[model samples]
Target: MFLRTPPLTAALLSLALLYSASAATHAKENAIASAKESIASSEKDSTASSAKKSIASDSYTYANLHDVRVSHVYLDLTVDFANNALTGFADLTLDWQQQDADTILLDTRDLTIKQVYARRVDGQWRKVSFELAERHAVLGSKLTIKPGFQTQTLRIHYQSQPQASGLQWLTKEQTASKNQPFMFSQNQAIHARSWIPIQDSPAVRLTYSARIQTDKDVLAVMSAPTEPGTARTGDYRFTMPHAIPPYLLAIAVGDLEFKAMSAQTGVYAEPYILEAAAKEFASTQQMIDVTEPLYGDYRWGRYDLLILPPSFPFGGMENPVLSFITPTVIAGDGSLVNLIAHELAHSWSGNLVTNATWQDLWLNEGFTSYVENRIMEQVFGVDRAIMEQALSVQDLKQELQSIDADDSRLFLDLKGRDPDDAFSGVPYTKGQLFLMFLEKRFGREVFDPFVKKYFDDHSFKSITTAEFERYLAANLLDQHPGKVSSEEVNEWIHGRGLPASSPNPQSDAFLRVQQHSNAWLSGLSTLSELPTTAWTVHEWLFFLNNLPLNITPTQLQQLDQAFNLTHSSNSEIAHAWYLLALKTGYRQVLPALEQYLISIGRRKLILPLYRQLASTPEGLAFARKVYQQARPGYHPLAQGSVDEMLKAD
Candidate 1:
């Protein structure tokens, strides 16, 4: 079974405290190295030939592949969403026969497998033995039988309607077509098997073509480059020229409407959501404008977005051609559509340069997250881009808090495909943070071109962290010579937590948590109260934002009158004190609650204050209007305190 972040307040506090200490030191040391590199590079630039030779001596560039290319794959997927079950069949053709007879595992959970077949050297296919006892379906077979690395077709039948795959999700859609009932997939975690069976591991990728059959009225969607032609009897077939890993192979079907901007791309959504979907699609041009330059032109033909029901997990899955996004972002407002650009950038980071295992998942996530930052920068602005990275840094700290393991890579095995192990720190947040570190190392003058080349060379092939390091050193590392030691960077690729990685003294945030610590706090709350679980940085920010928006000025004054600071509210409050502070400005009252904010280590939330102080005339006017109309209400906090809160800032 998989374990999640610990359910302890201490662990949560520990994560934030320790993570920042390491990150800050790491950053400070990096800034120094970067400055030296800039000065050195500038001095050596005019000696072109010598500079080029010296650049060749550097060590941080990611390496190029000598072998290991996913030649082609064929996918036959069958699913019954209403029943939440799936069966899949696939055929793979590799360039060289694998000598190790490795066990290829598919990301799956709680599934019953009836059969499996693989083509053998005996000129016939046999029912190969497999294990389904754990979360993954594991298969071990030799390819020597196929000698020169011939074609191998595999057939696997499984059944399960998964809720947590992060890749495949089943939910009802409210769209225009009565015929198209919308449902989606979100296989970010290792849950691809709950819907389709293949080498569900990202380590083994294959060119995928999905044959999906949904309810007749419903339309089926996949990441493949092409669309399903007419319903063709009862089933529809969609194929792609790109090699796709199982996780990125998505399927979305629902009551859908199809509108085309041109022959190259089409939009899919509920009939009623057509206009809403359009707003998301409107940025298509902007996405192209940014991603093309970063990864060297749009290699994928066209991009489309499929909006799933509101309850879909995660923001979206980066399905190559057609991305499956949560309708939660389909709000008439455009703020949420940046997710589309994020997934779109994955066409390069995830789809093109794939990670070999979940161990190096940062190869997929970190790169994608970074590239998503690029897309946002170009499409939105530098402020939005920096803001997004800031969110990630915050999330990493929270995840560190949630994780019970001091070792972040415990779940990752030597080859990076250990499904049954627990997660280590280097996998997600830390991994991505490393990429940002790499950017600071390379700097813009040298980094941009290197990144562009990196994508261009490795697109459509699998890349490991080690391989990436080789490329970095051979290219950029030589340029920065004294930067990271090859040994140090290589150690990072295969190491546990950093040598300097350590926990910090417990933070005041927990001490400042006055919501449930009062002498009278015990009885007023429900038996089952839900504190916002700060799983990701966004959730943590939401928890912070939750404080201000829900509190009011009047309630603040009242709270001052009968102070429990910890006074708990049993009522299902629509808003909380902190949330109201966020909107109305808690400047004056912040001095009163100064100890709590400092204890929580959120003394950095001055962004809200800066916004208030720097607001343009028009913006200030809007803020004042919102402030004047703010209503007075109580949640456990007092009404008078709420009034003071609005006037404080």
Candidate 2:
């Protein structure tokens, strides 16, 4: 279940080409270790997979300078909308290594390799088979066994309209973002293959240089920053000076008009978000304030973010640069800055120190969540931070009580989980809440510095569950003597569902609310009716969220009387009341609820409710059809839990 990997050597990555003797020795050792690990692990993995569908017969590994070292890659892509096809022209460098290594395979998905352009050290032109391509292409025509050569430099041409994966033509998912042109790539889950061809795995990290050509007005950015003099003719080029997993290789293109500002730390956001994104990013500065002091200096250059359309399923994807977030957070009201901060923290925990495989995803989720709270505590105050943590734990507990509580386990998989599950209660929130518990267990002064050490040592390398646990036990043993972790938490990583340790505040609150509501609702029977002023907004919301099993018609009338204020108030609670009133067929009071929905002002909530109402047998079909027709294209939010809403009963 685990891939064997050597411990990552201390960074032999020196910015200056000139190195001290010690540093040079370190670099050489690191390179040799990387090469040996690749060769050994590949061979071992081959032996292990020999009993399965094996690719070793034709597939092999060359030295990958992408991890632990700085290597540059450049590619030009020609994408055809008509055919849904792609062609890539790449110029990449292989660091100093010389041998009879001929089979150079790139991570390609059903791409056809045409021809390769390169100069052999022998100074002779020869045709090589760039052949043996089956679902993937090796990048050369001939196996030039040139020894004493330290690096390999070559250009390759690949063509294929790969299946929609990372870089997709998502015309369908773009409508929720105000019908603006939008696209997103969650490359972290190993979907980079559906887009570009390279070593498609996360283990082999690399520095990327890309020039993406698209229609004019198609703004561009990558997980990395754009290099100067590297862009041309709508070709958005980027240079990843830092080594990053291919999963973090992201690109978002839409008719984006973003303005930029430098926070001195790094450019915070592009200007396109002024109305919506800018407002959403209002609290983003707090994320910077809380995280920087704790995690040491920022690992990557400057942090930048982009707000995607509303259909974006996750709160945001931490794509090194330009973190793509859910468009819905742009409420223009700063109520949901916690989500903004959560994704921002991933820049350090998930982006910097990556989990080699999905199994060890807590290295990504748990750490990021913990850091999010740290950031929150700094900006929002410790009390608010603690309260938020309590609420998150409460949410996690409710999730654990679901018949499909195992679904909570999907949070850390980072693979095979639903797009909607990214901001899932378990992985992001509960995970953070767990970290909060750990913080209390250790206390801040001790826990805070340990977090910095955890990330700093593991940056740029892939880690597994075992490695994390070992570090946790070892690190904590050193600091919090006698501190021990049981199998309950760590063992939870391998399976689905929580570790039995997940909180359950919802059930507790449910019991209490059920009691209060039962008593309050029954007491209303003592009176003929409730005056409009009797039902407060907070009470109404609490009642709706904690609605009892079933209320008699008399009780419903009592409630209606309670909410029959002279003026129709417009608020979330008021909307709930109106919906309940309409549902109960309180013909006399339903008009106010209808008006309440109209007045909520969130343009996005209208169509769904209309469709649901129409679906009801007693509701007008024509009205439902009209609302359904207005529901436009592929916004994920627009498609959200429609069935769930319909099945609420």
Candidate 3:
């Protein structure tokens, strides 16, 4: 079954904005959607009145999951590099929680369902009756199947559409080798349904194994354990013993090779860059060692990293055993290895203990952020950790100024909206600072055990924010109410705006950078006189970000000539310089700025630059031109956001 949507016109988008202006309009629309959903849910509940059922996860998935419990999945797929798609079958093993339940609903998007079969109590598979529900713009379709009473497994044969949002196919020109094609999957925040027929919710976790067939010369890796010394025979097999949410099921197929940094930690890149990437990430095992003491053990057996080509969207995606990271973070000086720590921490907080739903996202991000700094402090130094925290605090304050006040809360009500829109520095930084506040009040010696205990109690389980709050109160607050109260904790978790008790993050290194920025603005120093010889990427960013918004082109020229930031190899520094160039209209750096925008496809670096350039007609035309060439290499997540902005008036 297939569903099609007409492309949106500028006039229609304007009309949409007008219609959305009224708060009542938003409320009424939500009420209508909710009522429709309630009627559907009511039917499912009515079918199994006596059997226990799980609450429906607050997600866009149409799965009637309350009556079924998925245990394992077997995926057999052929990776078609020429056509840029995955044609496969998924065999799922599940149990019916309610004896009378007779139907199964799975989530899918941009997928063509060819056939479905079920195994009966007689141990024979037979074709099953299935229906494709109506599709919403973002929610996709629900594949409902009527499996008879004694069925224990279902098999779905489907092929991903060319426009599958989770998959990105890159031509040879997009890679460093410039000779082989590449493809990868980005499935976070519910895009898994675009490529895989499964229950696409974090609230659902299951084990999976894969058999991937690709081109003879290409290598395929997944978020599961692979055999060492495997030959390139166009077929690869992987298995995961630990269960994970659908978003954690990832795959990459390309001209790639693996280099082991340790027995359990390694790096994957194209053959030409394998050694360099291995060297760059030599500290991965050390990070794991440091992280295990903070939380419990690293439950995931191996912590490997796949350094994808430049067009990968995010800084890092914490896939269970294999982390997909952008090449931009390989700054060659070991300055950006803290991102490794962050992803490694996710092995505990996000992979092992997941948020029950997207609304409790801070339960994953905030806890991971706090643990990331702890690992960085122990592996690196306290000063480096402080610098990272200070930068996060700076970013949080800036984010709070621009976003809705409701979005600033750690616990969010992201109903009737795309969960990806809630992603920002708010959850990471604010959650970390709130935990820091508790540590300050109760003291580290008292609170350290609680941190480890929380992870231990909830390992391998999805939890809501309320459950975490109850855990916090039962373990720490109830015993020592005089130190901190539940009301204060609520202010940080549910209330908007930063809490009064949030920690003040200070960095001595940034203090010096601020002084130089102040002196330059006060006319007491020339651009060449600033002491930046020992500055790191963070210091350079602070100096550039703090410059006055109304600075002249002459001042920018003097600074750019002195520092040569326009040609810097560091992606973070180059991104900062490009943004400043846009604000100042420093025409001299336009060529380098354009190169930066096209060469790096990381959404963190490019999205803001594109938005800033789209503010003026000439710049907008230039952005559109560069994007036309860059769009083929960009991931669908990045393409979706940039396409909307460029298409707008």
Candidate 4:
């Protein structure tokens, strides 16, 4: 309706409409500003994600390899035993991938950095600033150095702490000679950062050279071949021309003597252990000789063995040219030299072509293990190889019972965890089995060439599991479509538990041993009636491992009396026997077990005993007591493992 309003009322209505229009304009402006903020946030997130993807895929390292990488390293160092430290200056040659990068990153643990200097192409060293980030429990610290974009080289002056996780310093009493102190480095599975300021990931490979000054009384050895006829003048120089992951960087200083097993192979040990170690590992040359035709030629110049003291943690560490071996494996006879074969196999599988990250550890270990069995079969016999394979399968099955489903897969996901945790039977044995499955299907006639090609193609390169999977598909699986399916291969690598097609490694020797073990357990035969005179170490291990869990203490005593198991010189057999004793509450072996624990620090042989003991209250007390005494001598790796186990209890 059209009606005339009073002048005051009309003026008020017009003012109200103007106020509403102003409020609407302010609300529209606010909405537009909020939309702009949201768009900016999304763009920022996208940029961050792209930058993260540009970084290397290795989860265990803090290195910015996308911007800069180490091409080569030169170390000048003094081994100061008085302070139990390594005083060194590392000269790192950088490969600047991004020309704009003004800084470089390194990994370190328990290191005292003194100074950092950078050099440009003009060759003038200039001091640079650096920062050491807060230390992490497992990953250690991130070292960032602002060397500037013009820098070509970085020299870091540093000293390792006495209690560095990578270096183990031993008093004279702890060594075999008992006359000279010993020091060795165990740098595998991310321990290299504990001693050296490096890009310590397996993905980073670099050639290295070193000059080490030691006490005039001792000898120095590294993972490189020894200089011919070099005098022992307290100065040692080493050069590894072939690129290797930092973990393979190893060193030892001790009262060591060398004995030649062959022109290209030898053994280094204390004076007392020299002759026996040489004799025990005399077949190392044969192992190398046999491995070449089946796999590839050994590219490393010389393959030598270093017999570390009893406190060496693992059975053997495959340190390129010189493999560090535990004294426990020198079982008087050569039965344990299979460990040598395993390490030598690493020349091709691990050292030549390494797993890019710890997640693909199976690529190194599994392939090496499979090649080890083949080498053993060539040097020893098929029976020995079969027996070892069967034992490995059994060990894998038992390990699977305790490991998580994801961890049991051939391709491990070890993000946010120590690579050492991946060092289990899953990678070593299960990985071998997966390869063996393919070998069984394709036959060695066809598979051997593929394996040899795989090594040759990837030589001196670090590779990821996905890259291997693709290579396998194109080179093997797709090439022979009907034999093995890609789905099956994926299941073996990614699925939980063993596949139905997994190989069942059978051994006639083990069967005989099992039959004898069963007869004794069933009370149908006496322990003496079993044919034990000609039994090998593998047979003995099978016999001990297959014994019933409900076996009586009296039966154990009788067996010990018959075989002298308490005094068994074979470490593997002794370990198995001690495990049985603990299970049955047989206290007679306690003293010997304690002595064994104290003397030999090989984790494979002793950790099982400690774990079995910690399962009971009394056993836990005993384990704690023995560990307290033994902990002083163990490598930091072994110490941490046992500590975590006992802490859990």
lDDT of 4 by residue, 489-569 (tens): 999999888899999989988888888888888889998899999899999989888888888878888999999999899
lDDT of 1 by residue, 1-649 (tens): 0111112222223322332233435344234223222322333221111112111111111111112222344455565766655555454433333344334434345556666655444435466666654332222211212122332344455555444243333334323243444456656545454555433556545444445655665666677654424342335565554445666767776666666644555677777776667765687667776676666877677777776654343456778878876554554546555677778878788787877665456677667767777787888777556555555555456455655443454224533333423333356456655666666666767778888898878766666666777788898788788765776565555555533432121223332333533221444653134243322222333334334444555645544344333222210011133334435654444432332222111111221332443354543444344433322111101122223433434
Question: Across residues 1-649, which tens digit of lDDT does each residue of candidate 3 receive?
Answer: 0111112222222323333333535345334223322322333222112134465366667777777756556687999977888998887766567778888888998899999988654445689888987777888888888866646667789999878988888878788888789989999899999999988888877766677889898899999866555678897776665667888999998888888999888888888777877887888898988777767688666778998998898999999889998889888888888888889999888888888788888988998899999988998898889988988898789879989999999988886788787688878889899999999999999888898898888776778898899999999999788999889999999999898888998999999888888888788997677888888777888888778889877788888788888899999888888888888787777788778877878998999899999999989999999999888878888998999989955
Clash tally for model 1: 85
Off-target runs (Cα >4 Å) in candidate 4 are 1-56
Per-residue lDDT of candidate 2, residues 210-239 (tens digit): 656666645666787543223324555555
**Model 3, residue 78: displacement in angstroms?**
0.7
lDDT of candidates 1 onward, in order: 0.49, 0.52, 0.80, 0.84
- Which candidate comes out best when scored by lDDT? 4
Model 3 stretches with alpha carbons more than 4 Å out? 1-56
Lowest lDDT 10-residue stretch of candidate 2:
49-58
Candidate 1, residue 480: Cα displacement in angstroms equals: 2.7
Winner on lDDT between 1 and 3 is 3
TM-score of 2: 0.66
What's the CA error at residue 85 for candidate 1, in Å?
3.4
> Model 4, residue 466: displacement in angstroms?
0.5
In model 4, pairs of residues that clash are: none
TM-score of predicted structure 1: 0.59
Model 4 has a clash total of 0
